[model samples]
Target: MRNRVSLSNRLKKVASYLPENANFADIGSDHAYLAAYVCQNDPNAKAIAGEVNVGPLNSAKDTINEYGLENQIEVRLGDGLEVIRPGEVNQIVIAGMGGSLITSILNKQKNISLEVDRMILQPNVDAKELREWLDDQNYMLIMEEIIEEQGHIYEILVAEKCNSHQSPYSDLEKEKQLYFGPYLLQDRNDAFMKKWGGERDKLTRVVEQMKQARQMDRDKIDQFINELDWMQEVLNNEKNNMETR
Candidate 1:
């Protein structure tokens, strides 16, 4: 029987960021499945599976040991980059965490953050905030992916510290690219549209409720309207562009 380690589409996409033979770390590594999988597939690759909590730390160890990858992949228990010493790895992956927490992890560990050449991030929410934080830290957005699995839409960002700090937006509005993702905007797939379309519906409902309320907050209503308008316009623009082509 083949020993198989399954990765969700989101994680599989995350794994694609790794080079042929990478020195990598997976922070918030829930099961260390990604790390173990990569090491097993690429014999030359080595990985650190870092987990802050005991439950996940134990899971990571079990997975690595099950794969007999103890030599190639190490399971470390510590918060964020605290598990990763500077120069230990060339690529870093932080997945299945909130954007703010991801930013905090990178922010709190300057030494480890500066040592890596690449970063692969999958923020469950608040991705715009993460993009902004990456911009400030001089990480260049090199690739972006939007994947839908089990009815959930996940976005992955692959960046590098070539340190140019150049905006990837290419004449597009910075605010729009930050909120909507620069590469994702250019590659508006079904998952991306569905995610923003659902957001638009939710915002529209909330705006309607505010209008129907006996007491209305003008500022909140205006904010929701503005967001709703932006989403609708983008969706329409995509539609128009597709039609013209």
Candidate 2:
């Protein structure tokens, strides 16, 4: 089932955000490919590949053995952070999962997660919700990135625990950053516009189809209109400002 000859561009972007010489853990790691790759590149890197399912756990073990990364990468079978204890790893990666699941994993593993120095999260969707959770937990987003893969845009959030609550967004932009990420908005890369542009177009079609049903869908129409408005504003403003800044 594994087709990975090497790390995908998306995962490579994720790995690039890691701290140097980090002690890392990759939660829901399907085949430990990222773990092996990281270990190979960073001499001081050591990783734990955490998988909950039996099949994936076996797959991770095989990957570890195949790369002769047994000394560098450890394969463990457990759900989320259950396989890891507090202070075991300084950096943690929760990729290829939904935002809500990532939130729950962090919530459930709160006691141990306190020891984690950094988090590299890639949410398939609902990235806003995950950021909210991180905000509540006092994690400060240090950097953000978006990558396009197979016609899909993925958002990667790099955060670290902080003593005080310092948000990346100012009060004026807080609401906007909640839906579109803070650094993502500031960066405004092609992937960002493409993702939101596609979303706006999809909502446009949905609104058009709903109009045939008449006023009954007024509430939904209003919501879509709001989203489209914000997106239009962003693309207009950000696209123009890309080069000047």
Candidate 3:
């Protein structure tokens, strides 16, 4: 039986970054959709779908069987990178999860850098933490893309292991870039600006709320103001660049 699965255009775009010849590991591979997509499209690619939950693991196995892709894809139930052996896969994709969890999985996996050549990550939140971890680990950020799907903006990071290292941006720039994305800062599309604009307004409200409170609250408010001011400045600079272009 040939069942059809639809991937979001954003996901398809991210998948395009995968290496031509790769043994791909799809961490949290719900339903095995991405593995199936890569196996079918990339002639030289094979995949393993790793899911921690039994239900998703079974679903992935069923999808693999239904597609007659048993030879090309394997589904295993385990947490994070624990499902794969070192050197078995060169490309890893971790999506549809929080940044903290993704970073934790990578951090906990021993010698993952020796096994994997590249990583494609899409975090639902806390992307700053993930970026920071990448910098610390000496993973070079190769590409970044932003997509708006179902009224939510998602950032996809494509990185590869690198020996040469540079310090991560200052805390202020890091916060702004993580929230708004460094690549998006260069392009400065309306969607990117709109996302940060909404956040800026939210921070403004918090600043106002902190202003009327006691000393302890005032200290918290000051911290928020400092962050907000930094982000605001970045946004304004991006806006000016967009106008000139």
Candidate 4:
């Protein structure tokens, strides 16, 4: 028998969002580790491992074969969501990519995107952009998580379709939630703090550099300053929450 495929802490967290008997498509499935894992865990679950590149597609196929899950998991060579037709799966997973690219993948196939019951996205960076796209697409943010693994922080976003009357942002201010996740802002976990703290420090240095420039760009500096202020407020709120508890 083939050895069971193991997933990193990041992929494990992403898998936690999958529902029972999940029939899902994993876009950009590099090695199909996640797909094999879900199938191994849930015999009823079915997965389509879609890869755009020849190298990764072959790797994914090898993984599926080694796992002896050929019957449960299907490996396809195609870009983004093109491999799977609309309504083929209830959930879609697009992880280990930038938020902008993930957004572009979903935007490219609105029919399949809207058809799925759920979508779990893990963006390496620009999660704020993903959140904004989800909002525009009317996908309700059902769950959000931040995890630190191998000295890097990653964010997982779980969303589902919502009606026009419903919104993903809830009552929270849209702008803040757009920049900082609505759920992540509420939790303010250590990973979230570290990520934003680093960003705040980086922006502070940029603002200082701009101030020293011979021909300063006031508009750009103002934008950076505004973002700094928002980060400060979020950090302060987290500190106060800890103090009160």
Among these predicted structures, which one has the highest lDDT?
Answer: 4
Which runs in model 4 stand beyond 4 Å of their true positions?
A: 170-172
Off by over 4 Å in 2: 1-5, 210-220, 238-245
lDDT by residue (tens digit), candidate 3, 1-245: 46665678767876888888678899998799888887777667899899999999899988888777888898988989999988888889999899999989988895764457799999877777878778778887777777788898887888888867754355666666655567767777766677778878998987777676665576677778887886688788986876999
Clashing pairs in model 1, backbone N/Cα/C closer than 3 A: none
lDDT for each residue of candidate 4 in 155-225, tens digit (9 for 90 to 100): 99999987663665756588888788888988898999999999999999999999999999999999999
- What lDDT does each candidate get? 0.89, 0.87, 0.80, 0.91
Better of 1 and 4 by TM-score: 4
Candidate 4 deviates by what RMSD? Answer: 1.5
The numbered model that scores best in TM-score is 4
Q: Candidate 2 or 3, higher lDDT? A: 2
Candidate 4 lDDT for residue 226: 93
Model 1 — which ten-residue stretch has the worst lDDT?
163-172
Q: How accurate is candidate 2 locally (lDDT)?
A: 0.87
Candidate 1 deviant stretches above 4 angstroms: 211-217, 242-245
Which residue pairs clash within candidate 4?
none
Superposed Cα RMSD, model 2: 3.3
lDDT-based ranking, best first?
4, 1, 2, 3
